[model samples]
Target chain A: DAGVTQSPTHLIKTRGQHVTLRCSPISGHKSVSWYQQVLGQGPQFIFQYYEKEERGRGNFPDRFSARQFPNYSSELNVNALLLGDSALYLCASSSLFRDRVTGNEQFFGPGTRLTVL
Target chain B: ELKVEQNPLFLSMQEGKNYTIYCNYSTTSDRLYWYRQDPGKSLESLFVLLSNGAVKQEGRLMASLDTKARLSTLHITAAVHDLSATYFCAVDTPLVFGKGTRLSVIA
Candidate 1:
């Protein structure tokens, strides 16, 4: 009954370096989504994976990518990180894939705060 | 493309007072959600509004959605300091979020 969880609570990277953030969804959850939240702004969706398949993607640059494992865990990778990428990366899990009626409410993880220095 | 807009980017409320936050979206969507985030913290799901005229309430917070107007509102009744945080309303599944409304409650 543990909620969604993410690793490396804090990370500091250089402008050109790459970073990988991991997320473990709640048990029985098959959908995972990634989001980037800038300070003082709402989170922006990055990628969504359902049943270990790419379900949807946001308007983020090609530098941002993500994948889901068979166990419903997920990883978000950012390549050639820019100063603009310095934000909190969040992972959310939902029980259902598409139906909004129920179990589609995404519960979020603690998030990985990435700082590009 | 869906665009979400939230009003009063920042709000300062006195305890025991009442106020409302509004979210307006550009496109039609059946699903709308409200989330709360404290500083340096992740989002906490507050409400999931799925249909037109859907209203859900929890304690001092209430959320309602009007799909026809592409708008949703979060109302705070008798605000308390414990409720201070930034609130965001997102649209659709992929969730196009609006600029959040930061609420600060003062005693």
Candidate 2:
């Protein structure tokens, strides 16, 4: 079974430009989450979509948005990108069960490296 | 707001040595995860610890969680050069991560 996959291994954009990163979840996974990992820092959660609905969001600003498709693939878009937005964008997929007691193991992708010049 | 902290942001040890990484979170959460990442690579799941006193081990790495103290520990036993990487502990309140611990196992 293939793991979560992300596209455009590397991207270069300018300040005030817009960029979109895509992710395809593993088979049978229903939830997709986006994260931004700055160099030398841990990943920060941006958005989480479960069953095509926004389930959670992190401290990111409105410039960051994400949506999940019926097939559990997702796209993360950043508008008016700033120099601070340069980082590796990661995507993770998991099966969110109804019961909270179960531990959902998130599978991550080889994040897309975004650079704002 | 929840916050996660990892102690010893960096670790350097010779092969066959042992070390442990600590993770402390501000809020209560039962689900904790350990992930390893090589330079310029994505994260690889190491352990998923759920509930108080949950412990899991794989090869030379072991992870334990204490929900009461909101702490988790990743212990590396007899470390090898191949184990050199950054390790991160995350609390699954939808997943919040701590500053990773970069481990360099010298051979």
Candidate 3:
């Protein structure tokens, strides 16, 4: 089976511009999560959607928003991008998502590399 | 908010040597995860430890978790150069990550 897939392997945007990155979850998976990773750092969670509902969010700014589709695909949008926003955006998928007691193995996509010039 | 910390942010060892990386989290959580990320690459799931004293092993790497101490460890046995990469441990407060430990296996 195909794993989680992300689109637009690379993107270049100017400051104050907007960008959207897309992800398709694995078959039978219903939860999608977004993460931003800067160089030499671990990924920082942005948003998580389960069954097309917002389930969790991280400390990112309001400029970052995301939504999930019925098919478990997701889009992460960043508005008024800044040079500080330049990083790799990742998408993860899992069949289940309960933080402490329950959760299926999560898988990650290749990620979208975005550069704000 | 929960925080995750990793010790020895960098590791360098000779092939056939063994080393362990440690992860400590601030909150109580039973779910801990280990992931490997190569340069310019996405993360690859390595281990999922769901309970106290949970241990899992694959290939030359082993991961163990202790919920009581809120600690997890990833041990690399007989390291190989191919195993060079950054390793991160995440706690399941909806998934919070550590700064990651970069490992380099030298000849």
Candidate 4:
């Protein structure tokens, strides 16, 4: 079984441009979450989608948004990107039931490195 | 608001030595997790501690959680160079994470 996968391994955008990162969850996984990891810092949760609905959101601003598809794939979009938004965007997936029973030991992708020039 | 704090933000140790990383969180949560990440790579799940006294071990790494004290510890036993990376502990609710502990196991 393939693990979670992300696309566009690297991206460079301008300060006012928009970028979208994509993620495909592992087979049979129903929950997907987005995180932003700054250099030298742990990942910060951005959004979590379960069963195609927004289940949780983090401290990120309105510029960040995400949506999950029926196949459990997800897309994270950042609008009007700022220099502060330059970071690695990570996508994680987990089985909702298993996550609830156990802790959320989410499987993560290699992440999309976004750089705002 | 859940806040997670990790101690020894940077750790440097020789091979065959032992060290411990600590994670303290504010607020009550039943789920805690530890993850490892190599430079420029994504996170790899290490341990998922769900109970008050949950302990899990794999290879030379061990993780234990104490919900009462809202603390979790990752212990490295006889560390090896292969174990060099950043380790993070996270709380499940809203999925808050610590600053991470960067461990360098020198050989």
Candidate 5:
């Protein structure tokens, strides 16, 4: 079985511009989460979607938004980007919503490297 | 405001040496996970520790979690060059991750 998939492996955008990153979860996976990883730092959760509904949101600002499609694919949209926005956008998928045992071990994609110039 | 902290942000060791990476979180969480990432690559799931004193092992790597102390440890035994990678520990609440420990095993 294939793992999580992301599109636009790399992108370069100027400040104040908008960017959209895509992700396709593994087959039969229902939960998708987005994270931003700055250089030399760990990933920070941005948003999570389950069954086309917003399940959880992180400390990101209003400029960031996301939606999950019926097929469980997700898109993270960032508007009015800043130089600090230059980082890797990662997408992770899990089979269960609330894991009673292990809390759904997330499988991550290769991630989209976004550079705000 | 969950925060995950990892000790020894960078580790360089010779092959066949044993080492342990520690992960401590600020908040309480029943679920903890360990992941590995290569340069320019995504994270790969390694282990998930659910309860206190939970332990899991694979190959040369083993992970243990102590929920009461809010700590997790990843132990590498007889490390090999192929085991070189950045290891991250994550918690369930808010999905917070540690800064990660970059392991470089020299042959």
Candidate 6:
């Protein structure tokens, strides 16, 4: 089976511009999450969607937003980008929102490398 | 606030050596996860520990979790160059992540 896939493996944009990164979850998966990984750091969660509904959100600014389509694919949009936003944006998907007792494993895509100039 | 921390932000060892990477989290959490990422690469899931005293292993890597102590460890046995990468540990609540440990194995 194919793993979760992300589109536009690389992107470059200028400050104040808007960028859209896309992700397709693994077959049979329904939940999608987005994360940002800056240089020399771990990935920080940004948003999560399950059944096309927002389930969780991280401490990102309003300029960052995301939505999941009915087909379980997701799009992460960032507006008015800054140089600090240049990093690898990762997308992960699982069967559902995990519970403490029954945890779910998040499968990540290769990620989109976005460079804000 | 939930925070995950990993010890020895960087590790350098020769092939055939053994080492352990520690992960400590603040507060109580239900699950702990270990992931590996290469330079400019995405994360690859390694292990998930769901409960106290949970232990899991794959090939030359082993991971153990202690909910009471709020700690987890990833031990590499007979490390090889293929194991070189950054390792991160995450907690379940909001999936808090550590800064990551960069491991370099030299032959």
Backbone atom clashes (below 3 Å) for every candidate: 0, 0, 0, 0, 0, 0
Q: What's the TM-score of every candidate structure?
A: 0.97, 0.97, 0.97, 0.97, 0.97, 0.97
Greater-lDDT candidate between 1 and 3: 1
Candidate that scores best on DockQ = 2
Worst window of 10 by summed lDDT in candidate 1 chain B: B88-97
**Which parts of model 3 are misplaced by more than 4 Å?**
A99-102
Error of 3 at A35 (Å): 0.3
DockQ for every prediction shown:
0.77, 0.83, 0.74, 0.75, 0.81, 0.82
Give the worst 10-residue stretch by lDDT in candidate 2 chain A.
Answer: A95-104
Ranking by DockQ: 2, 6, 5, 1, 4, 3
Give the Å shift of residue A19 in candidate 6. 0.6
| lDDT (C-alpha, whole model) for all candidates | 0.93, 0.93, 0.92, 0.91, 0.93, 0.93
How is the predicted docking of candidate 4 categorized under the CAPRI scheme?
A: medium
TM-score of chain A of each: 0.97, 0.95, 0.95, 0.95, 0.97, 0.96
Query: Tens digit of lDDT per residue, candidate 6, span A1-117?
Result: 999999999999999999999999999899999999999999999999999999999999999999999999999999999999999999999887865555888989999999999
lDDT of 1 by residue, B1-107 (tens): 78899998999999999999999999899999999999888899999999999999999999999999999999999999999999999988887899999999999
Candidate 4: residue A51 lDDT (0-100): 91
Model 4 agreement with the true structure over A53-104: per-residue lDDT tens digits: 9998888899999999989899999999999999999999988834567565
Write one digit per residue (lDDT tens) for candidate 6, span B1-107: 89899998999989999999999999998799999998889999999899899999999999999999999999999999999999999998457899999999999
lDDT (0-100) at residue A33 of candidate 3? 93
